[model samples]
Target: MPERTHVPVAIIGAGQAGLSVSWYLGRHGIEHLVIEAETPVHAWTDTRWDNFTLVTPNWHCRLPGYSYAGDDPDGFMKRDEVVEWLNGWLDTFNPPLRTHTRVTRLRQGADGGFELTLVSADAEQLLTADDVVIATGGYPLPVIPTFARTLDPAVRQLHSEEYKNADQLPDGAVMVVGTGQSGAQIAEDLHLAGRTVHLAMGKAPRVARFYRGRDCMTWLADMGVYDVGVQEYPGGQAAREKTNHYVTGRDGGRDIDLREFAAQGMHLYGLLEDGRDSRLQFAPTLRESLDSADATYNSICADIDRHIEREGIEAPPATRYEPVWEPDDEPTALDLAAAGVTSIVWAIGYRPDYRWIEASVFDGGGRPMQTRGVTALPGLAFIGLPWMYTWGSGRFHGIDRDAAHIAASIIDRVARGSAGSVVTDGATLATTP
Candidate 1:
């Protein structure tokens, strides 16, 4: 038997998504408790590398009750600055938060409420709540391919989440797989640190940091790209699978083109196909991959240019990005021992984890089957999932909207007695009027 506590609402996670919803719940005078496994914003403070900075500009960081008021609105915030900002925001709101408490399990209680099993260093406790908001974030685990196990055990391997700085890795050439934002940035970091970096390219798009004197994010926001909903956008399903464009917050802000990396003497390869012992095989689509990335980047820039002209927006003079097709004559296959590659970093994005959730709220693919944060189950909701509602739903700029929507649903369920099945419109999970 464990200690039992009852609350009207239970919100899991204390990141931006959790805090944003907490702010709204507090404003509504709703009784809720936020449970966090570690300090608030643990992703920024603990998981991120020391040199990590936000991919989006500072002005894009908009929470429910707080907004960035710093001088450099157009600049990107580093890991520490982001942590400090989250801490300040948490302190200002002072929501009911239980730190160091991890929710190990969540199931339906005997009384039709949610029963959460919370574990801490001191003791385990059971909590019952009328409503539960799962804001535990979208990226819970790093995705590594099965072929990684085939690599030589002598070579040190680390996921992007585990990597901190170049000092932590062994002395030798490094091969970084996956050309998403993390892969691109980490390769650049290693290259600048005097390490021979070999980057495996993927299908991630590329975008210039600043275009037409405005940050790329600013232009996207102005063009309502962020507001595009999942169902509303064409090929939304495929779009959701695509990784964010390759850009860096480092060195002020600039485009991190793969061609530029090639120019910087970094070895570029197509996707890692198979690995056995010290030998590795790569796809022979290096040229095709580079061309595809450049085309995607140029298309976005062209859209921005057309938008500026159509709206008669007074922006700085723009320059078109010309692709520099420089094909390296390196072999598609490489022996790690011969190349002196001592370490490998897999910056291949993340996947959602729902093992602790005992309820049947997830689809077959382990993704929560919620419509815009509202689920078919009454008193149950979700926030901070990618493409939850809009293109930016998972980002700081978009979390507030999803949070507010979920908060409203939770409030309505609580007010309606928190019982019976929820009526959803199939596409939009809004309560019947």
Candidate 2:
């Protein structure tokens, strides 16, 4: 057995959030033990698609006090840039971290602190801490439906997480499912790569890039919309659902508009209304149904226009809607025979995997139930969830704000030892009451 260790703070997942927490803890003269399942920046270096670039521009890529130390702030940063930045941050902060060590379980100890079970090839290890930060991020697991498992074996299929680029796919027409940013971007890439593509668009809004021009996202942050549900209020959960709940693609990244997909010899279809049926029927009235998606589309396009004007460039005309590009709930029969797509890439979104954390902290849907980062149980905190605190909370631009708050909480908990203490000598504090 490996020698057990003890620390005042235990941090899980050395991603952006974990790094942020470590940096803050170090700044405050607090010692911490950070546990990462893989090498630093594993998700960005290993899991992301090859051609991926951040949707957020460089200028806003600020995490706490550290900014992306690249040449251009307005320019986009590739996946490698992000990875390098993370590694650089680690080098600078030099926090105590155990790589290749996966945290298998977290339990509340008799002392009301946290006990984390660690696993590796050689031996098991355990660590205790007064405060725990779950910075494991939101992309722990890919969401795959059971029905997708039953598809014909001849057809090659993969989740977006497994996809790297066009070379990873086999020769044939491709069917890209879902209409979110991933689906749209992947489908556009495949179609552009000389493959016949069929997109199975669900009830999703087709958004555009408006993030470049006016600092609207920053404006939203100032409006406190991201913090709306997180802070105590009536209908907090419901309000978060209305504003910041969904994963949307960066509209400013891709130029292939949904309205132009059909013109580029792409086929767009809809799912069968009968939830059980796999058969897809043609619905010619997609343009009418697409009206519902206008909110997302307009938001993106408006941001794009602002970007153009702010950059002092002549604004381009709004993308004219083609009648065929309209939304269709019931899509026409898609002829796979003609399309010759041998691969089906599901660009659907992600789901959190709380299996490693066996505590009773998650809801029935496997989502953690927390007041801010604080779970129902003490000594446990969740960091780096999208909109966990604000619109930019999960992004590089916003995670520091939440991390600072969480770090302050951890510092106070460590200092007081007892939750009942209502005062701290010289530090920011948080209380249950």
For lDDT, the strongest prediction is 1
Candidate 1 clashes between residue pairs 3 or more apart in a chain or in different chains: none
TM-score for each model: 0.93, 0.82
Over 200-235, each residue of candidate 1 has an lDDT whose tens digit, in order, gives 888888888888888888899999999888988888
lDDT of 2 at 275: 16
lDDT of 2: 0.67
Error of 1 at 335 (Å): 0.8
Candidate 2 per-residue C-alpha lDDT over 1-433 given as tens digits, one digit per residue, 9 for 90 to 100? 5667788889998888888888778876788988898977688978778766776567767665677777766566777777777777667767788999888988887777878889977879988888899999865777666666555566777987787888788888788877665776677667667877887765565544333333334434434544554455456564333322122223334443665777667777764222112333444545543554655656655555555566666543545333445443446665444456577787667777888776799877788787667787777899888667655667787677678777877777666765453332212333444
Worst ten in a row by lDDT for model 2: 242-251
Residue 176 accuracy (lDDT) in model 1: 96
Could you tell me the lDDT of residue 122 within candidate 1?
Answer: 94
Instruction: Give the CA lDDT, 0 to 100, for residue 347 in model 2.
Output: 69
Question: Where's the lowest-lDDT run of ten residues in candidate 1?
Answer: 421-430
Error of 2 at 432 (Å): 22
